[model samples]
Every structure is written in C-alpha cells, then in structure tokens.
Target chain A: MEPKMPRKERQIIATTITLLAVVFIYGYIIYKKYILENPELVYNLEFWGRKFFLMIPIMIGSLIILMIIFAIVNKILTNQDMETMTDEMDKLIELKALKISRWSTNICFLLAIGSQAIGKEPWVMMAVLVISCFAGAIVEAIAKIYYYKKGV
Target chain B: MGNCKIKNNIRTLRFMANEMTQQELAERTGVTRQTIVAIENGKYSPTLELAFRIAHIFNTPLQDVFSVDPDDLVLKKK
Candidate 1:
C-alpha cells in the first residue's frame, strides 16, 4: 500500500504540475498561433521582449489564482487551515530544495549563453533560458516531494 | 559519516504519557503533525534543539528519548 502523504505535500505537487501545464500550454499556443505565423518576429528582439514581458504577469496571476482556489478546496476538504508555520524541518527541506533550484538555474544559464556564443538565434537563447527556469522550478518541486516522502 | 543513525522512542513515550496523539505532541513541540509522524517512523531525525524540546515535553532525559543505535555506532581508536 502507498503511504499517505501530508496535505501540504499533496498541495505542492498538484500546484506545481498544474502551473507547469499552464505555462507550457500557453507557450505552445503562442508559438504556434503567433510566432510561427509571423516568422519575421522570431529574430525581432522587440517582439521577444514584449512576449517575455507579457508572460511574467500572466504567470504570476495564474499562480495567485491557483493558490486561492486550491486553498479554498483544501480547507473545505480537510477542515484545517493551510500549514503556514515554518519549523526547523520545514526550513531544512526548503533550503535543500532552494540549493537544487539554484544549481539547476546556474547550469541552465551557462547552457543558454553557450548557445548564443555558438551563433544560435536570439530566440534560441531566450527559449533555452525560459525552459531552464521552468525546469528548475519543476526540479525543486520534485526534490521537495522526494525529501518529504523519503526523509531529509 | 557512513553509519550515523539515530533511534528514537517517541512513540513509546507518547503511549506512556496517556496515549498522547501525534497532533497533541506536535502542537506541544511546535511542529507539524507530519513531522511527528516522520520522527516516529524513523524517516527523519530531529535536530539537537528539537530533540531536547521533545525530551522536555516527555519529562525524560535526552538520551532516553533519542540515542545512537548501538549497531550503527562507531568508535575511533585513540
């Protein structure tokens, strides 16, 4: 039998997966409907800048909305407020996950720069940077889940 | 470094203390219930400060609540 996980862990896993889907699906739709259609914009710094700028608020809004809905549902089901207090163990686990995310992000930065140095298009570098950030976020979530499940 | 393992008797102590629930122990110790569960299951070891706090809550000596497993203990040669 699978061991039951804490409510907080389950919340993290669900939110991370849902956010990842929102990001990637939104990105793909934009790439297909807008960028692909306007092939010229692929090399346009201004166009990429506008797209990147728009994405930040959209992602942040999605996260805030998702958290609100998740918290409401969680509260109704569990009849407990969200665990907000940070204890020693929670701090340790968070630090470990942050370390993993930082390292992954650094490596991704190196790879993105390397692509640019190798004469890749500006879009390629931007794509690498964006994808690397998403990868780091997902990796941190996975690391937290692993540590929570298997012990720190 | 290879064989450092901590063994705890939190579950037993809680039982002896009038069948204290994990939630009760966690609230008294200022930690989440999942953390208490993890300690009981041997999935995570508490820090020294937390260990002392747990011992204090049980009104027991620190060594009584937590100890190095004898089988995993390593001694250095002088």
Candidate 2:
C-alpha cells in the first residue's frame, strides 16, 4: 500500500498546482504579446475571442482536476473525516461581515456615480473601485473586532 | 439589537471527555472548526439549532449546555 501523504504535503501540492495554472496563463499572455508585436500577425476581436474561449476550457479543467485531487488528498490525510458545517456563531459573524461588505460596496458605487455626475476625471472611477475593495475589507475586519469586543 | 446571552459548559465538558479536540467536536456538531473554537473562546454565539445540536452531542440537557446569566441582564421597566 502507498504511504498516505501528510496534510502539509497535500496542501503544498495543491498550492503548487494552482500556482502552475497561474504561471501557464501568464506565459500565454507573454506569447500573445509577442504575436501582437509581429507585423505579419492579424489581430481582431474574433481572434481574441477564440483565444479566450480556448483558455477558459483549459483553466476550468485544471481547476476541477486540482479540486478533486485536493479533496482526495484531504480525505486521505484526515482519515475520511467529513467537512465540518458552519455553526450558528460562524453564521452570525459571516452575516455581519457580509452586511459590512455590501454597505461599503454600495456606498462606494454611489459615490463614484456622484463623482462622475459632478464632472470628475474618468480615471477617478478606477480609484473608486480600488477604494471600495479596501473599504469592504476594512469594514469586515472592524465588524469582527466590534462583535468580539462586545462578547457576541 | 436585543441582548441575548447564553452560557455553556462546553469547555469544561471537553476537558472531562478526555480532552477531545475542537476539530472533533466541530465535526460531530456539524459546525466549522473555527466556529467551535470561537464558541469555546466565548468570541461568538451559536444559534438555537446549533446550541441544541451541541447539547445533544455532549448527551446533556439543553439547559446544561447553555444558560442565561442573571448578571448579563439589563432591566427596563416601561
């Protein structure tokens, strides 16, 4: 019988597989850049669309395969232990976090719209998106801290 | 928000039950490992259903698993 790999080893393997996928995608972008630079190459929306469709399947396949491997490895390492369900406490925390994220996102989006209406630069919209993400994370973190401090 | 307080003996019971692992308890209680850790640390409160499940797992009555502390009460007479 083959020796079962430890949880740490399995996690490393899974992470490596994910990283490999990212690397492969980045390499494809470099290749596309090279093609775009070539005078002989004809670039059009249809050509790029075809490339995107091909890439999607490869990405999806890799993700599914990686997930399956991760599940198998996790099961083996944990001795067939089932995944734990989220308890009520976790649900409450998650609900609070989600509320924070939603409020932040909504407020940022509204502010961005207002800025646009007030004749702000087009690039300002990008800043809004970035700030929204940051604000969401901050709000979630603050909510967690507040709830913890309040003993809820 | 309404103040809802619940007290539980999970920490003491876990120690008496041969120092059972939090992960093991979480699995048995159908909750996330982090949730169990949070509950044990008194950082989070569980729902009624989850509380009953936990009580069932320890083979104890619901009152034994959880209680409302009188000290946590804040009275308001209308």
Candidate 3:
C-alpha cells in the first residue's frame, strides 16, 4: 500500500467532501422547489439523470482545484518537501478531533429528528442543520487544540 | 481513577536492533507507521493482540512490550 497521505492533502480531501455534501444538499432543495415546479423544465428522466451523473465530474474538478491550492501552500511552507506525513502526535490529535466531530454530528442528527417529531418548521430544521455543521467543525477544532495541549 | 500511564521500551529496542525506522518496524509487524509511532510515544495503548504482535516483531516477551502498573490503584482484599 502507498504511504499515508500528508496531512495537508487529507485536509483538502476532507474539506472537499464536506463542501460537496453541503452544496449537493442545498442544490437538491433548490431543484425540488424551483426546477421541479415546471414539469416542462424537467425535460426527461435521462436529462435529469445526466445532471445527477455530472456531479461526479464537478466534485472531481473541485477536488483537483483544492489539491492544487493545497500543493502550492505545502510547497511554500515546506520548501518543496511534500513527502513528509504529519507527526504521530498530530495524527492522534486529529483522531481526537474526528471523534468529537462524529459525536457532535450524531447529536445534531438526533436533535433534528427530535425537532421533526415535535412539529418544528422546515426553516428551523434547515437552520439547525447549518448551525450543527459549523458547530461540529468548531468542536473538532477545539478537541484538537485540547488534545494537543494535554500532550496526547 | 486509575493511573493510565503505560511504559514500554519499543523505542530503545528499535534503536538496538539496527536502528529500525518506525515505518520499517510497522511494516514488519503489519501495522500502520502511525500505530508504531503512537505506541512508542505512549499516546495510544494497543490491544492485547497488537501488543503480542509487536512483541513478536521485536523478538521479545509480551511483558517487554506492554505492562500496566497497579501500584497507583488501591485494591480491596477479597
């Protein structure tokens, strides 16, 4: 197997995935409300199917652009040495961060379900989702800093 | 609460055994380089199966690879 990717590359990939997921969810909402309102605009199943398939290329292009930016930053920071992986301690800190993020995400999902059961508004649900994503990211960053400080 | 600090000499032994790199040792033991690094740094405690594998890779006893100190925990007599 290939060596583990550098932390910068991993971060770029993670960010790209998160960005694509958020964009796709928001785009789906718009498509359902605006585009689907006119059946004539729907054209055919194949046409909409093609658009769905097109997301792969769009995501790939976004990832490539992200990687290019990451590569440039990595080169500038490391003086062209990109082969170095993150240190062990840094990886542990990332693991802790991911753990916290996972927990936050799960809690947010449960809260969403709970709100839905209580007849919450759609806009409120959307707000909760957006805020939860940001909160999860913040929690992850905090967890990383905390673990680093604790020397774990 | 119990003292969770664990002590091992994997780093010292790795040095003695031709100064093997963490990556090389990790490969020999069929684990990720990060796992080896974590074990050496005491940031993560490996499971019993992994501990045995590490000990086997170093040609050392299992106790040489990992040990829990119970001195900090007060035990009740049965």
Clash pairs, candidate 1, are: none
If ranked by lDDT, best first, what sequence of candidates would result? 1, 3, 2
Which has the better lDDT: candidate 2, or candidate 3? 3
Candidates 1 and 3, the one with greater lDDT? 1
lDDT of 2 at A90: 49
Higher-DockQ candidate among 2 and 3? 2
Q: Which docking class does model 3 fall in?
A: incorrect
Please, what are the lDDT tens digits per residue for candidate 1 over residues A1-152? 22266776887787788778877887898889888898898899888788888888888888888788877977887777777777887888899998999999999999999999999999898888988888898888989889889888
Q: How many backbone clashes does candidate 1 have?
A: 0
* Clashing residue pairs, backbone N/CA/C < 3 A, model 3: none
TM-score of the A-chain for all models: 0.89, 0.44, 0.52
Residue A49's lDDT within candidate 2 is 47
Q: Tens-digit lDDT track for model 3 on B7-78?
A: 889988889889989979876766666567667888767667778887888899998777767764566455
Per-residue lDDT over A75-148 for candidate 2, one digit per residue giving the tens place of the 0 to 100 score: 77566653434446645766887787789889998887887899976545545754575567567655755554
Q: What are the candidates' C-alpha RMSDs?
A: 2.7, 7.4, 7.6
Per-residue lDDT tens digits of candidate 3, residues A1-152? 23254454355456646565755675686579657786564545454455546655776676677767766766776565444455445566788889889899889878877787899755445546655766787678667655543446
The local lDDT score (0 to 100) that residue B65 gets in candidate 2 is 70
lDDT for each of the candidates? Answer: 0.86, 0.65, 0.67
